[model samples]
Target chain A: MARVVVDVMPKPEILDPQGKAVTGALQRLGFAGLAVRQGKRFEIEVDGEVTDERLDEIRRAAETLLANTVIETFAVSVETQEQAAAQGQPA
Target chain B: MARVVVDVMPKPEILDPQGKAVTGALQRLGFAGLAVRQGKRFEIEVDGEVTDERLDEIRRAAETLLANTVIETFAVSVETQEQAAAQGQPA
Candidate 1:
């Protein structure tokens, strides 16, 4: 199976209410030096023929539906267990 | 510095409009065997002596502000380069 992960985040200038709330909480918790940002992640699992061609389709889907075209920027990744074991380890 | 990441996803029964849209797109893209879900991720970075006690405070912040106490479940992790390198070396 192939998993496509998409992460979407609001532009730095866009006011993120959720992020602001967390920032305030962090400050209250004595983490005076933390910067927080709220964003979105979507996990899509696909079976049968995981190819670069298929990934392009999913990437387009993320851009059109999973992410807001107006104020958010997104990153897309298509991964498999073998791929994970092959390249740089995930953070 | 330490970073905390919180991921939030709707309950299975909850209507995920973003997810639904992605599902539709995937189906159209010929990924008939795939299931898609949409969710949120928040990244927080803090400076000034990180400790176990500080981590507890951040966990609470994630529960309170980073996640909706109602329908979403979240996972928290504290990681650093040294830890990653140690883990990667495979003892």
Candidate 2:
């Protein structure tokens, strides 16, 4: 199976309270000089080969359902076998 | 500035209701043969160069704060310039 990854992140202009809270917590915990932004990751396992057409479909899905276009943006990419192995996932 | 990416995913055996809901929604929307698991992504911007020690520190931060070790697994990686450009993020 091919795995597709869709990442949905808040727009640069948007304020991310969750990220801000984490940043503050990290500083309080003595981890400094770091700025964080939080987002969502979706791993979709497809039953067949990932073709360009399939990628397009996934992209459309990302745009339509995975991301809030008004305040967020999404990127879709296919997870390679090497990456799967590195993550200790079955390839 | 250097960017580090931390991805936190639910344990394989854990129930992912959000992902399951998304999967059902996709099927209802005519997108088929896809199973999804949802997770969290954190983008951290470091003020200085990323050294091995810094990476270890980030890993610690991820383990202590970014992920719930009981039910989530996290991976930390540096975001290369190429990937930033591809994602339309400032490098």
Candidate 3:
């Protein structure tokens, strides 16, 4: 099995209603000293070996659907259980 | 420091354009036996002790902004390096 971690963020220029809300609440909740950025992740478990080329194709698919290329940016990475373990995460 | 993981998923009935696209790609990529769902995550690092109550406040803030209580759903958890490591992740 393979793990794919993807993050899709709103176009920087576009207004993120949710992000705005969180920022506001942080200020009210005594977390005014910090700033917050919002994004998303999709943890997918796919069967079979994920070749680098195949992974790139998946990233493209995510970029096209999960993000607005016009303004938003996104990234995807594929790794195996051993790789994940080496990174200090559970296999 | 705190690392908060949040997942904001579109309402079940709402069409997930991103999720759909991924599904198509997975099938095309020879992952025909699988299904896909897409969601977002927020990783926030805040200084100071994260008391349980403070964490709740943060979750509420996230819900109001990052999640659509009406149609979408989300979940948030707070943990220290010790807890995270206990769960098998490097804190």
DockQ metric, candidate 3: 0.17
Q: Comparing 2 and 3 by TM-score, which wins?
A: 2
Instruction: Please give the distance, in angstroms, between residue A70's alpha carbon in candidate 1 and its true position after superposition.
Output: 5.3
Count of residue pairs whose backbone atoms collide, per candidate:
0, 0, 3
Better of 1 and 2 by lDDT: 2
Whole-model lDDT, model 3: 0.61
Per-prediction RMSD in angstroms? 7.3, 2.6, 7.9
State the lDDT at A47 in candidate 1: 77
C-alpha lDDT values of all predictions: 0.69, 0.87, 0.61
B-chain TM-score of model 2: 0.95
Order of the predicted models by TM-score, top scorer first: 2, 1, 3
lDDT of 1 by residue, A15-40 (tens): 88988887887687755667888888
The order by descending DockQ is 2, 1, 3
Q: Is candidate 1 or candidate 3 better by DockQ?
A: 1
lDDT of 3 at A14: 71
